[model samples]
Target: MSSYYGLPVLKEPVWKVPDVPAYLYLGGMAGASSTMALLADLTGRRHLARAGRVAAAVGATASVGALVHDLGRPARFLHMLRVFKPTSPLSVGSWILAPFSGLAGAAAASELTGLLPVPGKAAGVLAGFLAPAMTTYTAVLLADTAVPGWHEAYRELPFVFAGSAVASAGAVGLVAAPAQARPARRMAVAGSALELAASRRMEARLGLAAEAYRTGRAGAVLRVARATTAVGAGLALAAGRSRAAGVAAGACLTLGAVATRYGVFEAGRETARDPRYVVEPQRERVGAPGSEVRGEVHRSSSDGDLQ
Candidate 1:
């Protein structure tokens, strides 16, 4: 591992632990819950639909709060909303979040207050239409960074996030409306399967970057995430009208989702902390073998000449 006196090649991400992870988790949950709400409404599962709407609203609101807290002020979040750059993931995410939040709140309010039912349903449908992008755009946002673990896994990260989102939303449904949770159970199973498969495939394809996910704190959390998600899925399959089993599965799934986000964040930080992750990839890109590159230290003289 060649480096300048063992210093990292890339700066660590400025994102904080709990806040950023919470934002990611809540945004995903909100987006997918909106979709679940729409689906439940269409299928005449009124209770499940109402539950989904409330979850979406609360999640979106909380996600925004988390983001603002991380930014250190409310103005910074509002500053982000001033620009609408289509090419920037952050900008697009802000736009998506802004409208989605409003729509979700409106829908939830209407469902709860029994006012303006028609417009509320319309808002729910619109929010549902945007839900897929809302759920997965954070993956794009993370992948857009130079962090090796996130950038290298870009191909599969969106799928992983989407699956996680679906699973989390379904878990909420199971916990909130157990009696009408048939669709939720199926969603939980399917989403967990997808999340596991995508995550495995992402790790396998990450090559050298995969180490970030298999070693240190990141590895420990991800292992727990996988185990819990798998167990949750299995429990969901057998739950079948058992409220206790469903609630237990939901708890496991929620924990798994939270762990996965934190694990990914930690992995990216780990990759950034290691110069090898940055140097080796550059070497490969430039047709140089990893071992051929050597680190050299240079000092500047008083006259600004390198020595």
Candidate 2:
């Protein structure tokens, strides 16, 4: 094997901070808000339903702005939609985001203006249907890349993102609509638990490749996120009796979710900088006893274990 000690195994992600993380956070909130709107409408919680719709619209719209800004040009984003590739997460995500933005905006407008009630309800339903993909596809987009921190955590990343989405939606609902507080609290607690568990599991499963999550600035951010998530979820579960407690819980959840996004982004970049993460695992895979063929390509069967 050729030895190149200082060379990077993969290119660092070209995405800028704040912009990419903002896009991720807003996209997730958009999806979660759509789900909240649907659930609130079904349960006759009009205030929450209206707030959820509005939040969905705002989040979706802002997400597009963040995405376009990150792309550095509106034309590039427009060009991305020129083709639909089933295997390309960016292509599929763009398509999902487009309809989702329209539907969410329409639904919120109808609620705000009290016009076209039937069409608004239909739009909300459609947005809810698309919300899962909107929230989870970001995870898929990251995992589809060659970054060790991302691709190696594919299995758990979806759940982590989904949980964060639900938690964020719950936080927004709690802060925006007092009537649906109970369900919102429940969602926050459940979502935080899921996020924490999935993150720990992903790190554990990554084995040696998980260093990016353990020993750097990314690790510090993730550590804070875990602490805040735990504290926030605990407070949320017990926040029913006091408005102050509820708001505090909501703020913590929002903070934790943002921290998680930044930490994940940083971890992926850090992983790409280290060559051992790229070479060692593949080397072991190829050298394993009873391997199919000498120097044959190795496919990992371990869940979320990347190349």
Candidate 3:
């Protein structure tokens, strides 16, 4: 493999560390919390439902703040809402975030204030309906990028994200309303299992791109994430009405989810910084004798169509 004067083929992501990772964490938590709230309400766990609503509202608000801070201007976010492009994950994500934030806020307010109960339930339901997309769209956004680590893992990224979201929401429930958190315990156990399994599969299948997740800062955080998530899930299963144990499990789960997001972000950045992640794959695709010319002709026609 070779590079153009030893330079990275793709530009490194400009997204700031804490801001982008925080947005991903909070958005996923908010989306899953909304869904959990609706489920709790249906199951007659009023306290748990209320807690979920509040968590969703606060998470969504903070998520938006983090995003706008990264963009350096609120107008940039508003500009995203000016057009809805289904083919573009960013555009679709903006639309999902806007309504989800509003609905989550309304649901939380209604639940807390005892006013407009009808509208609050309606808002909660609608937010729940949008929750899955809200939780997973960030994965799509990441995968759509040119970064090898992220793009190559697209097949399992959504599952990893969704599981993390659910686990985070469960953590909130455990922390906020442990007395009525049976459903949360179940979610915590199930979500963590799914996340761990999907993540392992993604890494195993990533080939050379997996180097980004196996070395450097990304690897350290991901290792911690896996350990904490597994511990949290085990603790959740044995908690069984023990408030202290539930809280401990919740804390561990929250840390794991945060670490996972940060690790993934760092892995993507690492891939962009290394030229091999770019050159080696293309070389393999066009390695055979006479294949380079044929590949160039195919790419030329594809580029023409795209143009």
**For this target, which candidate reaches the highest lDDT against the unseen true structure?**
3
Regions more than 4 Å wrong, model 1: 288-307
lDDT value for model 2? 0.88
lDDT score for candidate 1 against the true structure: 0.93
* Lowest lDDT 10-residue stretch of candidate 2: 294-303
Please state every model's RMSD to the true fold in angstroms: 5.0, 5.4, 4.1
lDDT of 3: 0.94
lDDT per residue as tens, model 3, 70-180: 999999999999999999999999999999999999999999999999999999999999999989999999999999999999999999999999999999988889899
Off by over 4 Å in 3: 288-307
Residue-level lDDT of model 1, residues 1-307, one tens digit each, is 6688888989999998699999999999999999999999999999999999999999999999999999999999999999899999999999999999999999999999999999999999999999999899999999999999999999999999999999999999999999999999888988899999999999999989999999999999999999999999989989888999999999999999999999999999999999889989777765643333322212234445645
Error of 3 at 134 (Å): 0.8
lDDT of 2 by residue, 1-307 (tens): 3337777878888999899998998999889989989999999999889888999999999999999999899999889889999989989999999999999999999999999999999999999999999988999999999998899999999999999889988888778876577778888888898999999999999976688898789999999988888888888888875778888888899999988888998898887888778888877776888767432433443443545
- Which 10-residue window of candidate 1 scores lowest in summed lDDT? 291-300
Q: Quick one: RMSD of model 3?
A: 4.1
Alpha-carbon shift of residue 232 in model 2 (angstroms): 1.3
TM-score (all chains, Cα) for each model? 0.93, 0.93, 0.94
How does candidate 3 fare on TM-score? 0.94
Best by TM-score: 3
